[model samples]
Target chain A: MQLRLETKQLNYSIDGFDILKGISINVEDKKMVGIIGPNGSGKTTLLKHIYRALPSEYKKVFIDGRDIENYTHKQSARKLTVVRQENSSDFDFTVEKMVLLGRAPYRRSFESYTKEDMQFADDALNAIGMEAYRYRSFNTLSGGEKQRVLIARSLAQQADIFVLDEPTNHLDVHYQWSIMALIRRLNTTVLGVYHNLNLAAQFCDELYVLCSGHVVASGTPKEVLTPKLMAEVFGVEADIMQLKNGRLQLVINEAMTAQ
Target chain B: MIKNRVATPNGYGDIDKSNISSVKKHRYIASFILLPFLYVLSVFLACAFGSSTVPIEKVILVLKQELFGIVSEIITPSDIYIVWNLRFPRALLALAAGGGLAVAGAAMQSVTKNVMADPYVLGISSGALAFVSIGFMIGGVMLNTKWFLPLMAFGGALFALLMVFAVGGFSNTSSPARLVLSGLAVSITLNAVGQYGIYNAKNISSSNAVVSWMMGSLGGSRWADVWIPILSSLLGTAFFLLNARSFDLMTLGDETAISLGVNTRHLKRLAFIVVAMMCGVSVASCGIIGLVGFMVPHIVRFITGTEHRRVFPLSFLVGGIFLVCMDILARIILAPNELPIGILTALCGGPYFVWLLRKNKGRG
Candidate 1:
């Protein structure tokens, strides 16, 4: 059952400053949508609202054609899981146990984990190539490893929809590609905030470019990533080239000059 | 697959099939059972050892005889008075205070995301002291009722927390560092207020009574006064355990917990109230015992690891035991004079606190 994500006239403000103003977006069934923006562009704020981290106004967000605000926190979590960036912790848990916490939404206040929950957690770890690290202390793992474990946790939630906020903030290049590829392979309805324009353009089926709290441009990567839009919105001068692999490759000359 | 091998910190080397409820849980189960028993033993030992040093067998026989309400004069009434009326109540009070303080500390550490947090870090104890000091200044019927002091202390705790929040300028973006700094500043300010209030009091009592109360004392603890600590600690510990998973998630920070379906704000409010009440009760009964609230959780985690499930229960038991044993030494060391419970806690907590800080020295 594929659900469409729709947002209409979403407005958010803090300290009399508008962070997002009358914003609207829609993600089609099971397609990956990436929201890319420069710093302070309200990309994280938009995603935060969708995931109920902040209070969203009534009827502003709709998932599966029903208002997202209508769902309780637990109900929404069961349908939509979040793979957050920078999940650092002071306390330590085993990797398996961290993944097992993803089952919390399915559990009642008094319920303990059953055999099926363990199986699901194990499978998630296996899917993310983190089964070997199941017994490792969560905080002791390297950044890339921690990110993978967090992804496994979200997967264990068994949600058809996932939202990620700056999903690859501190990852190295290889892990970045691998992590994005892992999400692509999952075939879930994904809404992600990305700082890396190239990665978003590469993996996302649809793209939304947020600039200064507004959707400056949005479409398929090929359609929205024109030279003018790049220069105007991103303050960058770039040559969009179609290489032998038929992938859109952005080559920049004097990229630093735009800033 | 039926789980077989166990995963210890040294890697999975245990081969017993029964030892396989995931390595950490199984090992912790042992400590959980063993530690509470250790606490009971220490309580009994504490009951037996004092200025007079009653025999353990006599103490046990008295306890058993009392359990059945059969007074066959097995132990003399004086010994019985020391063992049952005076010693047991004091020891039980210490256990409850320690257990409650430790659990509150564990919860506070997670809630504040600060390793420096104790049960009273939000100035609950100081707040209680301030209120009690104010009461001392007013004197008369205000201090006459049995429940009056604790209830005042509890109110003071909530007031102190509010002051902390007001001074801290609580916001979603404020780092844990900022919050802790704000709380400490408020605490220092309140401490001054407490001292000033006591110093200027026009009451017809010794000034030492107010000072000793501020420093923390379990002296003259009657069975009548033990329930506040017992009830609040039990509720706080139960709250922490029931929401233990949320506590673990909170260590990961607020945004992730919210996304994972935790009502972070609600849990935080609940934790704050519970910690405040626990600290208030402990302070009212025992006069602001500090070390159990601060170091017991850390010491327990050093051995049991930082998993909340293990940390909470173990800290509760060990904290109780540690304080009781320290109180035993307090009763015996000076001979006819007793040291304040707070002083004993600091004596032990100081070295361990230094070591923990030194171990984490390289990192800011």
Candidate 2:
């Protein structure tokens, strides 16, 4: 296994309040790694540092053993792509044009997208089963359809790594599964922040459970999702079950009462 | 493979990909070729109609004579003077001011990510008007200098933009609401300063001149005054066209733009400077022409969509034609006395702006 992305003791604070305290995580090549935590546990904050949206210390993050700070924004974009839930815009563009914007990192100022670039966009839309909607206005699409189009955009980037921040937020159950499945099929290094523990358990090869800006436990889903850890970290009473299909399922029964 | 069972097939099924390409090509043709032709026709018609109407045939003869030195036996010196000197330069100034304001508005809206942003609303125009008012208070000698007024106006506009950026925070952290609010604050303060300067003017005539200029008129446009607005509008439009892709990405929000490889900070700073220059020159050419900036970009966007490549050039031409038509109406509406172009634009734009606010209320 090769390490594709690693964050070493990442620390971030705002106005004397710590958001991420010496957080560390590793994502290997072609693996889907999930981060799960309660709200305000800093899952999104950690992802921000990984994606360079929030600046990180020079030596804190690395991609393929090279410091992320060494790459210009364009260079880093060619190496990694991000798909976020907040992809909505006030303006509208055709679905095809929206996907074509993924080629921005590869293009120079005033340079039009080439035929080859257009093909990449088309192929991405097809892969996401959205070829029929290519001419549709992006903002006019439903939530699920818009998420699919955004995924296709990430595909068009042709990067080796994908960082998704709550990509299935506000999506229906069907869309959540379908979007997660689509991402799983990419066979790339994926770092995802997921709210649904079951989905994270089923799709992620490994899971990191965050509580109060600390990685309290991390291992295979079976190892990390024990009832005791759930009660302690999530303040919930949960029963872990093994389904006949060889999938792990968590049934969260009730919130733990405060002492 | 995940089954493609998500969305039900709709009318869009019949629209093939090739059809989209053809439609885009048509848009390109309409934007680049047809719009330019329409602009030329509008300029010609504007030359023909004014307080003293010249026939279209005579306007063409003057143009032909001036460009090709083809002397016409039917042409009079007054016809030559009206078509070439008076109406022609005024029309050109109107064209340049309109196009510049529209382009500046588009850029400002994109960079700020607010639909209501324009040079006038953002205090750039107020800054120029304020500086010009102060120049008036300094008496006629300073106003007589060729470059003094525009230079002062540019300085004031730039100062106001910087102040807005400072108050709004030029970084990605600044919200669109913050930027607009700061712009309004700066605009109101500068407008008050301009009013105070006018109130203290030495003569009533100089004060009246300032008032009329503030209301915006192309009545003072000369050939020498035409070049600054023309050159600035062209340069600003060119700079924006080249960065259209970046502008498109910017509309997606700051984090997304950065993730897509756009240097948002650098682009925003450069765009603000360009917009300031464009707005300053337009204001200097013809006072504070309100609402052309806010109105024209919206109209162009409705026609051509939000792609800046199409929107910028089309807005340039369409704005030029729209203002030329407005100026013609201004001339004929009062016959010999001219109505301020700014008043007309405000009358037209105010209602549309209200409608837009209602439309956007849900989104906000």
Alpha-carbon RMSD, each predicted model: 3.0, 3.6
Query: What 10-residue stretch in candidate 1 chain A is worst by lDDT?
Result: A250-259
Give, for candidate 2 chain A, the lowest lDDT window spanning 10 residues.
A85-94
Model 1's chain B yields a TM-score of: 0.89
TM-score of chain A of 1: 0.95
- Report the C-alpha lDDT of model 2 over A21-104, residue by residue, as the tens digit: 989899999989999999999999999888887878999999898999898888888988999975555577878889998999
lDDT of 2 by residue, B162-273 (tens): 8888786345566556766788899999999888877887655655566777888888787888988898899999999999888888878777888888878789888887
User: A1-259, model 1: which lDDT tens digit per residue?
Assistant: 4557889989999999999988999988889999987789899899989988888899899988889878877788788888877645456676777898899888764467889999999899889876666666777677888889989999999988889887687899998899999999998899999888788878888999888889988899899888888888877788888778656877666454633
Q: State candidate 2's TM-score.
A: 0.91
The digit string of per-residue lDDT tens for model 1 on B1-364 reads: 3344434323433234223235556567777778878888998998888778888989888888877776666689998889889999899998999899889888888876667666455576788777766766775776778777777777777788788777762454565556657667777877887788788887737766656667777878888888878888888898898887778777777777777778888888888788778888788788878757678887776666666777888888988898898889888888687778788787777677677667755544
Mark the 10 consecutive residues where model 1 chain B has the least summed lDDT.
B12-21
Q: Which candidate's lDDT is highest?
A: 2
RMSD of 1: 3.0
Which residue runs does candidate 2 get wrong by more than 4 Å?
Answer: B1-8, B11-28, B134-148, B162-182, B201-205
